[model samples]
Target chain A: MSEVRFGILGCANIARKVARAIALAPNATLYAIASRSIQKAEKFAAENSLPASVRVYGSYDEVVEDSGVDAVYLPLPTSLHVRWAVTAASKKKHVLVEKPAALDVAELDRILEACESNGVQFMDGAMWLHHPRTAHMEHLLSDSNSNGIGTVHFIHSTSTMPTTQEFLENNIRVKPELDALGALGDLAWYCIGASLWAKGYKLPTTVTALPDTTRNAGGVTLSISASLQWDQPNKTVANIHCSFLSHTSMDLAICGSNGSINLKDFIIPYKETSAKFDFTFGAKFVDLHIGWNVRPEEVHVDNKLPQEALMVQEFARLVASIKDCGSQPSRNWPEISRKTQLVVDAVKKSLDLGCKPVVL
Target chain B: MSEVRFGILGCANIARKVARAIALAPNATLYAIASRSIQKAEKFAAENSLPASVRVYGSYDEVVEDSGVDAVYLPLPTSLHVRWAVTAASKKKHVLVEKPAALDVAELDRILEACESNGVQFMDGAMWLHHPRTAHMEHLLSDSNSNGIGTVHFIHSTSTMPTTQEFLENNIRVKPELDALGALGDLAWYCIGASLWAKGYKLPTTVTALPDTTRNAGGVTLSISASLQWDQPNKTVANIHCSFLSHTSMDLAICGSNGSINLKDFIIPYKETSAKFDFTFGAKFVDLHIGWNVRPEEVHVDNKLPQEALMVQEFARLVASIKDCGSQPSRNWPEISRKTQLVVDAVKKSLDLGCKPVVL
Candidate 1:
C-alpha cells in the first residue's frame, strides 16, 4: 500500500475529528466514510472537508469490505464496537477502535481474537498515549535518580464532563441500549487507562468500586468511583472517578515515594500543539516550615502534529509495516487495550456487586 | 486581661514554630516555656530568642500554675495531650492544643469538660483554617451563582511528609508510647479537618479505611488512605491520604457539581504572606474538544500575618472575650474539634478492624 487508506465506520461526532486527523497524517488518506444513512455520510464528509477522491458509503459493511481501504477506524457506540470491529478485522482491515473498545473484556477478547486470526493490527483510540507529553512523563516517572520520582505509591485520575439536561435525557451515552456502560465506559476508560499507564501497564491485584455511584433511570451508570490496589514488596494504590454530571475536568496525579507528577489536562491538553505537566523531586519544607524548599517544575512538551494526528500516523505506520514486511501484528497495543478493558469489567462487576472487592 | 500570656508545654520542634507565632501575634505573648529539664527549657528559650521576661520552667506543672500565664499552648505529643490539656484547663488557663487534640474523642471530651468547668476557651492548632485563602475559597464554594461551585460532591486531601530513616526510627510520631496514633494523628488530622471544613463541618455517615495502610513494627500506622461517605439525599464522598514515607506534598481538591477548588498547598501554603488557589466554575471544552473554554481563575489571598500567627491571634481574641468582656467561651472551637476527633477515632477503628467501614 503506497499510503494507508482509511475508512471510518460511523458518522459519529468523534469521527469528524478523526477524519481530519487522517487527512493530516502524511502516511494516511481519508479513503472512505460510511453511515447508516447515505445523506448523513455525505453531510459528514462535506462538513469535514474530505478530499474529492474520498468515497462515501451508506452502510458500514460496505466500507469494511472495500478492498482499497487498508484500515477501518471504528468510532461507533460501545454496543456496536464488538460487531463492527470484528467484522472490520475479518475483512483484513486494521482496526483502530475508540475506547472503551468494547462493552467488557469478553467482547474485547472476541474482537482481539478476530484481529489475530486475520493478521490485522489492532489499536485503541486513546489518543493521549500518542502525545509527546506522555513520553516525557513516562521518562520522569521511570528515572532512577535519587531525587527523581521513586517507586509509584499512588495514582489518582478523574474525568468529569458535564452534560446539559437535554443531552442527559436524549444522548446515546445515557441510553442503556446504546452505550450500556454509560459514563464508566466513556469517561472512566481514560482514567483507568491513565492509571495503568502510570504503573507501566501492570494490572492491579484487586479492584473495588466505592459506594458513591449514580445511575440514570435506565440503570446506566452516570457517575462512579473505584480504587485499584497492588500489593507486593511495595504497595501501590490507584483511584479513578468519572462522572457526566460534574463540571468538565480531566486530572491525573502520580505520587511516588520521592516525588510526584501532576497534570490538570491529561486526556486532552489545554493547547493542541503544546502540553505541560508539573513534576517535583524530593520536595521539602523550608526552614521554619513557612514555605517549600523547592517548587514543582513545569515541563512543556511541544508536538508538531496534534495528538490525534499522531495517533493516526502511528496506526498507519504499523499497518504499512505489516503490509510491506509481512510482519505479525504489534502485541503491545492489543495487550494494553485488553488489560484496560479487563479492569473496566472488574470495576463494573464490583459496582454491580454492591461495591465489593473484585480480585483480578 | 491586658494581654493573653501563653505558656508553652514541652520543647517539641513544632513548639518552636508556634512560640514564634505567639510572639508575632499582637495580642499574645510567650510568657513561659516548660521542659522536663531546666537546662533544656533554658536552651529552648535562648535558641528561639524568647524575651528575657519569659519564664523558663523545669516542669509543665509550673507553667500551668504560673499566675501570669493566661493561656497554655500545648504542643505536646498526641499521647500526652489529654493529661496536659486537662491540667492546664483545670488551672483556669485557656487551652490552645496541637492536633489530633488527643488520641481519640474520649480523651478530648475530658479536656473539653475541664475547660467547661473552668470557663477556659479551647481551640485546636490547625493553622491553615485561619489563612485568608481558606476564607476566599469558602466564599466561592458557597456562592449561589450558576457558575459558582454547587453542592459538594466530594473532597480529596493529602498530607505526606517524608522523613529521614533516623527520624522515622527515633521521632515521637513513630513511637507508640509517645505518639500512639502515628501518622494518622500527625498528618491525617489536617486532612480530616480540611474535609470537614469543605463540608461545613458535617461529619460523614461512614468511614472506611482503604486497603493501602503501612505500619511500623510497633503496629502504629505510618501511612493510611480512607474514604468517608455521606448518604443523605445528595450523596457525597471524601477521601484522605496521609503518609510519613512520601515526599512532602499537601493537596486538597474540593469538587462540586458546578465547579471545583484545587490547591497544592492546603496544610501549609507555599508562601507565608500570601496563598493562591485555583477555582473553576462550569468549565467546558472548546470546539472539537481540543482545549478548555474557560481556564481556572487563580485567586490569591494576602495576609498581613502568617497563618500560625493569625491562629494565635484568633485564639487570644476568644480568650480575651471570656476574661475581660464577660462573654461565654466560644463553643464553635471545641465542638468542631470534637467532631474532627470523632472521625479520627472512627478511621483508627476502621483501620484496626481489617479495613472495615465504621459507622459514624
Candidate 2:
C-alpha cells in the first residue's frame, strides 16, 4: 500500500516532533508543512531537516486543501484546534491534533462530528498510549491468571514540568489567548487520559478539583489537582496532579487487589528505544511484617520505533484501510479522546464551582 | 550507659517484631511482657525465644509498675492506647507507642501531657523515619545547593495492603470496637506521616477527604483518600490514599522546583539492611522533547541495623539521656507525632462531614 501523505498545520514547537514522527513512520510520509508566514514554515522545514520534496505553505488552509495529503497533523494552540481540525476533517483529511483536543468537549464534539460526516479518522496526540510498554502493561492488567493485577483499586498520576519565568509570562501554553486552560489542559490531559486508559476508558462517576488550583495573572490555571471516583463494584479512585511550576515528573501508579504497575516517566520515556515499568504481583509482607515477600520486577519493553512514530504508523494504517479497502475509520481513538475531554471538562467545572464535585 | 529495660504491653502480632527490635538495640533490652493472660505471655516469650531473664506478667499494670522497666512499648489496639500510654508516662517510663498515636488528637494529648509532666520521652513507632535512606532524602530536600529539590510543590503517597475476606471480616484492624479508624489509622498513618516528613513536618492549611471513603460493616473505614493543601508561600499539596483492599504499596513521590524523589517502598523497604530511592535532579526534556535529558538516579543508603532496631536504639538513647545525663527530653518527636495526629483527626472530621474540607 502507498504510504499516507501527511501535512502539518503549524510550525509550533511540538510540530517539530510530529514532523520527525511522520518521516520515521514506515506507513507515513511528511508531504507538507505550514506556518502563518511562509518563511517561518520554510525555516521550520530546514531546521527539522525535512526532505526537499516537502512543500511549505504560508497558511494552514493550503495544507487542509491539498489533494495529495491523506492526513493533517494539527500542532496548533488549544484554542485553534477546533477551527483547523474541523477544516482538515471537512476536507476528508484524517485529523491528528495535539492534546487538550479542544477548549472543552463541546468544541471537540464539533470536530468529531466533522470527521464522522467526512468519513475521516480523528486521533489525539497521546503518544504513550501507542507505546508497546502500554500494551504489555495492559496484558498484565487484563490477564485473569495470576499475572494480572486484580481489580484496580486506586490510580495516581502526575505531569509536571518546571518552566522559566519568561515562558510563564509569554509562552503560548500559559497565554489565555492561545491555550486558555493552561496547565489544566496542557498537563492534566495526560494524567486524566492515563487514568481513563488504565480503567479501560470507563468514565468516572464524579470529578472534583482540589482547592490547590493555582492561576496565572490572566486566570489561567498554572497548577491543579483533582480526583475522579468510580462507584462500586468497580470502586476505583484516581488522583491527578498537574503543574507548570514543578520539576519534571511524569509518574503513574495503578494499584489493584493483587498487584500494581508503576512508571516514573510515563508521558515521555527517559529514552526512546526502550521503556521500563515496575510490576509487582501478589506482593505481601513477610512474616512478622518486617519486609515485602517480593520486590517489584522491572519489565523492559523494546520498541523498534519511537512511540510517536508508532502512533503515526497506527493512525496511517487506519487511514490506509479507509482509503484503499473502503473500511470505516477506527472508533477506538475517537472514543478515547472524547472520554478524556469529557473528564477534562468536568474538572474545569469543578474548579469553577469552588472544588465541589461535579457528578457525571 | 546501662541498657533501658523495655516492657511489652501486649503480645499482638506486631509485638513480636518490636520484641526483636528491643533485643537487637544495643542500648535496649526486653525486660518484661504482659498479655492479660499469664499463659499467653509465657507462650509469647517462649515462642519468641525471649531471654530467661525477661519477666512474664499477666497484667499490663504489673509491667508499668515494675521499677526495673525504664521504657514501655504499647502494641495495644487504638481503643486501649490512651489508658496504657498515659499510665506508662505517669509511672515515669518512657513510651514507645504504635502509630495512630491514639484514637484522636484529644486522646493523644492526654498521653502527651502525661509524658511532659512526668518528663518521660515519647515517640511513635514509625520506623521508616529512622531509616538511613530517609535521612539521605531529607538532606537532599533541605540542601540549599542545586542538590536540593527546591521549594516543594507536590507530594503523592499511598499505603495499601491486600486483605483476605477472612482477615477483612475478622481482623482487629477492621473491627470498630478495637480500631474505629481502621485503614485511615493503620495505613494512612504511614502515608500522612510520610507527607508531613517530606514537608519538614509543617501542617497543611486544610484537609479534605475525597468522596472515596469505603467502610467495613462495622462503620470502620476500609479505604480512604484525602488531600492536604498548604497556602502560599509554601504552596504545596499532598494527596494520600490508604486502603486494606489493595495489594501492598507504599509509594511516596515528592516534587519540587529542581527535582523529585520517589520510592515505592517508603514505609518499609523491600529489603532491610539497605534501601534505595530514585532521585531525579535537574531533569528536562531533550531537544524536540523525545526523551528526558536525565533519568532518575537510584540513590542507595545502607544501614548497619534494621530500621526497627534503629528506631528502638534512638528511643533508648533518648531515654538514656534523661536517665543518665539529667537532660530534658527532646521535643521534636512529640511535636511531629502531634502534628500527624492533628491531620489524621482533620481527615476523620472531613469524612464525617461528608468529605468536606476542614480548615486547620
Predicted structure with the largest TM-score when compared to the true one: 2
Q: Which regions of candidate 1 fall more than 4 Å away from where they truly are?
A: A143-147, B143-147
lDDT of 2 by residue, A1-360 (tens): 789999998898999999889989999999999999999999998898889999999988888888989999998999999999888888899999999899999999999999999999999999999999999999887847577898888999999999999999999999999999999999999999999988888899999999988999999999999999999667889999999999999999999988999999999999999999999988988988888999999999999999999999999999999999999999999999999999999999999999999999
> Which regions of candidate 2 are displaced past 4 Å?
A143-145
User: CA lDDT of each candidate?
Assistant: 0.89, 0.93
What digit string (tens of lDDT, one per residue) describes model 2 on residues B9-103?
99999999999999888999999999999999999999999989999999999999999999999999989999999999989999999998989
Candidate 2: Cα lDDT at A20 = 89
For every candidate, how close is chain A to the native chain A in TM-score? 0.98, 0.99
Checking candidate 1 for backbone clashes, the offending pairs are none
